[model samples]
Target: MSFFVRLSLVLALLLAGGCASLSQQQRDQAQGIAVAARSTEVNCDRADRCALDSPLRALGGQAMAESTAQAPRHYATILDEGELSLVARLNLIRSATRSVDLQTYIFDTDDSARMVIDELLAAAARGVKVRVLIDQLSAISDVHMLSALSGAHANFELRVYNPTFGKAKLNYLDYAGSVLCCFRRFNQRMHNKLLVIDDVLGVVGGRNYQDDYYDWDREYNFRDRDVIVAGPEVREMAANFQAFWVARRSVPAERLNDVGKALLRGGVPALPEASFLHPERIEWVDEEAADPDFINQAFVATALPVQSVSYVADLPRKHRRERAEEPLAGQHLTEPRLDALIASAQSEVLLQTPYLVLSKPAQKLFKNLRKRDQPPRVVVSTNSLAATDNPIVYALSYKYKRRNLRELGFNIYEYKPFPLDAPIDYRQLLPPALDGLPPVPERNRMIGGSAAGSNVRGSGSGRKPSVNGSEVERDVLRTETRPSFLGTRAVNRPLPVTRKGARMGLHAKSMVVDRRIAVIGTHNFDPRSENYNTEGAVIIDDPRFAEALAQSILRDVHPDNSWVVAPRQKPPVLSGLNYSIGKASEALPVLDFWPWRYATDYEFKPGPDCPQPLRRQDPGFHACYSAVGDFPEVDVGPKWLLVRMLTAFGAGLVPIL
Candidate 1:
């Protein structure tokens, strides 16, 4: 029988019998697992000295002061310019001397993930206490190997949040079983992505430890963003990590499987170089020559002069509170605090998220914002139908609810993927379809970034220069008309990277408050992030850093990068009908754009296609997906129809997915 047939059989047994019966040997294997219900309390951040001044203080030349005394002043350095973001993360790992605490939603079994994890293991071996807390949903592949890595060193510990029964690390079947068996808890995942080393530095944003997050994927790359926070506020970040580390919701990796105990047997080395898959991954970056100088510069560059900084977090058990257990009126709630932060915005607000399923309460908050006489200028940037990694979310939020959002003064911009610039190298890394991409203009990416009031195109390269006797015009066009009453502008920005990749997905979750205060974290301003997952962010209230961040975001709204979404004409009848149908059927909801989902041609893809380097794909092994494959999740047999049926009838699930 085929694998699908076997999967269906196994699922039938699982649903009917609750679980399959284990053989004597299987039972023996499981008996060795540390299945004890209680966990020992431990301080993961005992060595945290983030509150003190570091020997290496960043921005010594820059002049700035904080607006608040209670908050520590720091700077935010955005890694959105180019491939510098990739090294910035790795550099943080290498710079750690005392401890490294990493928590994320997903850490896939990809080249990027391998390199980062290997670095962590190396750090642990160097007596740097390393603690890794990952959402169980993302630990599907390489679980056994990860468990071994965790047990290999006494200083390293791996804990998974809300795991399921059976071969969780190897199969996606356990997700369905988990959702079916424990619907409520299973949906409430830990969505926060955070990394802090030695209690002083924290990197938070939408990135998970995967190849796509780092723009290294062969087929697609995420045009994602992350921010670095250093200084005293990192202590609070560490405290929040400690709380989650000991929470009842988090389970030790060894408790989930027997392989954790056999780690000492040491069959395969967990180092990235030893892997058959990514043995050559470490060589991607020319380390020996460039690394020493780069690391030194990055150590100071990553740290910013802060006016003020604060950390915000949702309790690990945010979704578990019962109706009666809810805090009384006027009580400060952790999950609701993000809303409070938004409410504090005075003149302007720039919101960026990936998935956007608004809850009833959130809708009401927007309603309140609309009622203000001088409402803050609200601009929201999220994934468009073509750019979204999760099409189901697009069906629900964009397909069904977008018009309503437009009516509420939301200047919505669907994030456009960075075009595959064909002027760069990576001859062996990417597929043949991707060629002639632009190179990262390292000279243009100056240390302090673009100055305020300079022309948007000022890279010191002067005027729009031509390459190879042709203008490097991008393919994106502005679809929005000027001066609508709704104050709603739709803009799509081009990906700034010059990497050899087919497409880009917007995975950055961030906000800019009044153009001075910035926040970066993993919370998607949607129902899933608001009510179903634990999320966090670090707030940097500094003018210089915020200006740098704003400069990057403003470029995304530039006409050269994205296709603006505005009503040149009334939306089509079919579009409206499909949206209504989608609302009625959230799961597998189809949009009018459904038929065009597979439109992967460079000429027609969502973002601007750079004109001169007109590198058309081979049209086979599509570089983009139109709601079919499950990457970083599952690959086969799990039908979308099942979700469709559930969405049509199961109203309770609307708040979950």
Candidate 2:
């Protein structure tokens, strides 16, 4: 045989072998495990009407009035760190004798995530019906982990809320399809985080199933807060879960066969077998556990409830005029609620937040109080430069924040790291140096004493100069007038400006109105949260509850735990040069505003070394910049980017990804 022919045959053989191996791998990954289908259905329309007229009506009304009273009411404690919240959540799941419904934004394959999975599997093993509904985007992200949970138990049933097959994987052909699907899926995201264990106990809050949220790592521990309800409210949360569960977008886990087998082989960690068959060892507490005397004082001194203590959110309208101006506007308790609650306020409005970037409307709301005939004191606590995990967000925030709020005549405070009694060190809280060094402050000293006999100006230049003339004159004057001017002309110095208020507490997001009613929820007052992400929360009506939560925040949480932003007496002054530079940066256009411009112009551009002619437009610049700029660079690597592109494109067609 000729040498050329032999080489061709060898190449063919190698290609064929590679193709067989790839096919088998794909087959192995695609194998699906069957999941037994079971669900608990509650008709909310019927219940809503029945609830208004039933004996439950009187119970809910009375409960609303003295909601904070120490009755034998059920409540769940939200622990902020470690496996504490997970442990609490799992314990409730295990104790369930009837039905368990769990819904979350993200469920990972991490230790804590797997632990919950194992427990759910066990619950299903014992004939306790368990339904798990997770967002498709999140589930597909952890398909392997979720599939393992599905394969291990028949009683366990899982569904993906909004799934797009081609969009989910995005191999080469799907990329084009995904682009067409992007628009419909981009704005629609499932931001609800809930866990309803049985129709009796429920928890709704901000924390997600990630390590950073649980405080497993000191560097990323989120200072967050959540609420647990034990009464009829649990039923409401359960219904919310069902509404999303049965929605057209949701699909059973059995549908994703390929993803399931991979997860099963990976094997979800097994739950430790333990019995909490009795309630005694559960460490569970009810409303009665809270001191009654303190509870009574809280109720009697409680301020009126915010306007419409119970309110519902209106969905975004499809038509322009009918659309709610802001989809998230009514999610929290409104300004009328704040007014009624804040009416009796005497001293202060203290706010603690990890992310303290407030919108223009929010800024106006806080500023209006300072405009009052006799404005009450107001203080804010937020993260300093060194303490924040999201520096980009902080940079964009502090850029216009202080000056705007100060201009509105409100005292703006920034959190600084210092001992509780120590003064703030303002320079330390400035954006951290890239090389990790403390910023040096420039000194400008003015000398005017009789011994010196003249005014002298010390150079305002930050760096020290080599000149010796000023030092010689200063030495002679220091020796002669040191004793004469002592205690004679005391310089009236202001308090040492400290950066003590810059480290805001974590995870707890709340608004206290007149120390009366407090609105606590998973929503952070951030642009990403307000405009981009979906969120939910409850507006508690009880004054005692609000006061207790508020005091807990101000006293225990805010003092040593949080940094305080110092309130400025006047608006911050910026040079015209700086103002112009800022305006120019804001005016510059970015690609997120126009998504498709980059594909042909930048993405398909050939390399310079290649002999192929360069395209007139380098679409790669748009593609490259858009990916780097718009999406969070962390955790989402090249492969994830490819997936995101494909998903986004697919979402454009399906309207659900």
Q: Rate the local accuracy (lDDT) of all candidates.
A: 0.54, 0.42
TM-scores of all predicted structures: 0.70, 0.53
- The alpha-carbon deviation from the true structure for residue 205 of candidate 2, after best TM-score superposition, in angstroms, is 1.6
Predicted candidate 1 versus true structure: per-residue lDDT over 118-183, tens digit per residue: 777666655677899988765434655754554456667878887645333523344456546666
Per-residue lDDT of candidate 2, residues 1-657 (tens digit): 999999777655544432222133443443332332222233232312122121212222343444443433333232322233554556556555556798776665544455566667666656666888776544335454444544555556777765544122223222223334442443344556777755655666666675435433312234455555555465667776776777666666544533544434443433234333223312322121123332222221221222223321112221112236675344433233443444445556655555666555556665676677877655454544444444334434444443434444433333332223111112222223321333344221211111010011122212111121111111111000011112222111111122222222245555555565555555555543444345556566555555655654553222233322322121246444444454443333321112222111011223454334221223333222111121221233443334234322321211111
Error of 2 at 556 (Å): 7.1
Measured on C-alpha atoms, candidate 1 has an lDDT of 0.54
Off by over 4 Å in 1: 1-12, 15-73, 170-173, 258-273, 276-281, 284-292, 296-299, 323-335, 400-402, 418-434, 437-501, 570-654
lDDT of 2 at 139: 38
Alpha carbon lDDT of residue 230, candidate 1? Answer: 62
Worst 10 residues of 2 by lDDT: 472-481
What's the C-alpha lDDT at position 129 in model 1? 77
What's model 1's TM-score? 0.70
